[model samples]
Target chain A: MEVDRTDGRTPNQLRPLACSRRILHRAHGSASWSQGDTKVLVAVYGPKAGTKKNENPEKACIEVVWKPKTGQIGKPEREFEMILKRTLQSICVLTVNPNTTTSVIVQVVHDDGALLPCAINAACAALVDAGIPMKHLAVAIFCCLAESGYVILDPTKLEEQKMKAFVYLVFPNSILSVLPEVSSTMKGEPMEHGIITSVTHGAMSENDYFLCLERGRAASAKLSDFLRRSLQSKVPGDSSKAG
Target chain B: MLMEAKPSTSPATFVDKIVVPGDVVLDLSTFTNETIKLGGGLRQDRDAISVMKAGKLKFSKPNKYWVESSQRRYVPCMEETVLGIVVDCKADNFLVDIKGPAIAFLPVLAFEGGTRRNIPKFEVGALVYVRVVKANPGMNPELSCTDAYGKAGEFGLLKDGYMFETSTGLSRMLLSSPTCPLLEELGKQLSFEIAVGLNGRVWVNADSPSTVVVVSNAIMNSESLSGVQQKIMVEKLLQRIK
Candidate 1:
């Protein structure tokens, strides 16, 4: 089956993105994001001591809370918590800030189709707002292979349910150094792994698998650009400041 | 270090009106050879005079033009009382919803120095008076509910006043009249406070009897203050020579 992808968007096209940091007051760091009609607000608290005995350790711990549209929590929220914790841990340099905890609270004030990936982006923005150090940003993207042979990038809710399989990818970007300048730092080699973390759910054909990766990579690049721009705008004096 | 220069553009447009990734329509007849400045509205493309793509715009409006755009920051100043509800409590601090991007925290220590036990005794949902102490860009704002006269003691609570939603611009315009004698006539001082949060929540408490009457009339009429109407109403309210 063929899908009509209108709006002149490529199979891996991302919606127009707008992000503003320090959007909320009480939290240590906060950001508000909008992609098309999907809007999400994320607040980051802590680096403070964790109250959970078991979870508290010498290293910083990450906590994710998802508040849905109905203003209630459910299975989806639980799953998001797990996914976010795992994804954030991969990029967060927790060892650097021991005994501190980073809490990421995501509120989906509005929903369109691609919420999970949007939430992930918002979370990353919040993390930056919170001033937490990270090896790299864990950018995410959603892709699906429709029943008909079309590969969809950043699939909306309706498109997701109609697809045969879905994939979520969280990756990082880093500058590779040509040589090891210090004994502590690893030198040379493809230095920048910029490894892509992908999770595929449901069954799909081999062709769909390759297509999903291809679309995922393209979407990731677009999101990375947006993340960079958002961070740049919030920095102390990059000229975006209002005099 | 290489610094990126901001492009020289004319000011005749509002930032919100500029469409992203879209073209703009310009009228060259009104355009001059010299660089024109655009504030918060539209601009014309010089080349074609007839059409121009939207130009790069600033995110927030400058303070000179207090137009209540979504991107403006909320700041509190002296003598301007604010109305806010306590949303959360943390030891000596109370998180009050002042209708901004972040809840403004009121420290119990800012209150009048007293020996009252149970120091920071403020309950959730309790409305209180607060004055903006300092609004630091990189730090959470500091607020005090007490002023020289007293601890905002009872002046902050709203007993018989009406509550309604309005924009920040309208609220600012209403409060611009510092000494509204009309408000004092009804046996109440024009010593009311209001908070216009960025999140669209408006909290107001008017102590002036005439001011209360004006507020009631505005609410009953479902009238929003803007342009001429707002100016006229504010002028009339400040005309009381008592």
Candidate 2:
């Protein structure tokens, strides 16, 4: 019972990934990330002045604004913004810049599949570019479950529509540290194995969800490595040397 | 894996190397007899000295270490000299934008040998070279127009100069000792007065506007170029200008 993908790829294959940083000169930090045809551009501004109303003035506040490919922002955009903001807040060192607000604006450049995951990755790169104090970087990936209990690593837009369920997962990038045995763990899993954020669509069995998570976690390692290498290569002084 | 492999335990080996956040640059177990000073973009967690941002790890002789990163925005730090524009004049302070998180407060009495009767009159949007006296969290930074010795020195109103903004990394490069290649090359031929602020603002004054434009543009473009590249770039610009 094999499911054929229109692109004629294996069930575990993902589309090519492309990322570029500092595309917008005016924004404090900006990045554009594309996974196949899906593209998202994110700009980070501030830690400026004060926080919004109802936010504690003692801690830095994160605000997110999501812009769709066309038209005004609606319910789905709002939900995306909230999820992005919370995911970002968990990674940043907020107390370092108290009584301030850091705004992350995500602009949808294109929609194919795994758009949210692409945006999250773009946002993470932009934050790093901005020199915002963060504990670590997060890598995001998307996985879908097929009818035959097969899990696909990354699905195209058409495949997404045909899938029974899909999930977006964010995980912390694994670290290669100098200190021995500093690896943190949650329960029995290593720290990087812990999920930072997860979003699901449609109903799926518990086993299917766990299977998606397992596949997604595996894919995130490769994504995070790519993210790390791309960022390191573009570092100001290093790039000139490499070139 | 080889690209990200940091030096094993010696902090000295990490000096002048690129480091990312969460990378432990210093393992204090070996430094039990030494006291190393920590600067921006680095923090001590337990016995490990960890980086707080992605940047080149810089080390100064005797005991100083910090992370150097180029960025568009400026974060306020104590005792950093910067160029600021007066945004508003208040009773005891002048609100200035130093390209930081909040508007910095320049005390009205911060000038050299100033008093209530002789407070210098400054119009809105006037540029001033000042030093940050206080940069505390949860509050606007405080700036002073005089040095720590209460002397004006080079801190005062910057008059009749064309000011532009660049990245903080570029400004730092311009202010580094032994001089930067781009500035050194430009100065060999053109006579100009330049003020570099750590906040990424650059003010250039020359005999003519064309000279100012050439010098400023050269400095801006030199950010990503190596020393040899900067020298070559400057030579080409000078030839074109001539």
Give the C-alpha miss distance for residue B211 in model 1, angstroms: 29
lDDT of 1 by residue, B93-158 (tens): 888866543467787666776434646577788876567676543244567768866555643444
Place model 1 in a CAPRI quality band.
Answer: incorrect
Q: What is the fnat of model 1 with respect to the true interface contacts?
A: 0.00
Off by over 4 Å in 1: A6-8, A174-196, A234-243, B1-242
Write one digit per residue (lDDT tens) for candidate 2, span B42-73: 88778778887888889988899999998899
lDDT of 2: 0.86
Residue pairs with backbone overlap in model 2: none
Q: TM-scores, in order shown?
A: 0.47, 0.94
**How accurately is candidate 2 docked according to DockQ?**
0.64
Interface RMSD for each of the candidates: 16.3, 1.4
Count of clashing residue pairs in every prediction: 18, 0
Off by over 4 Å in 2: A182-188, A235-243, B1-9
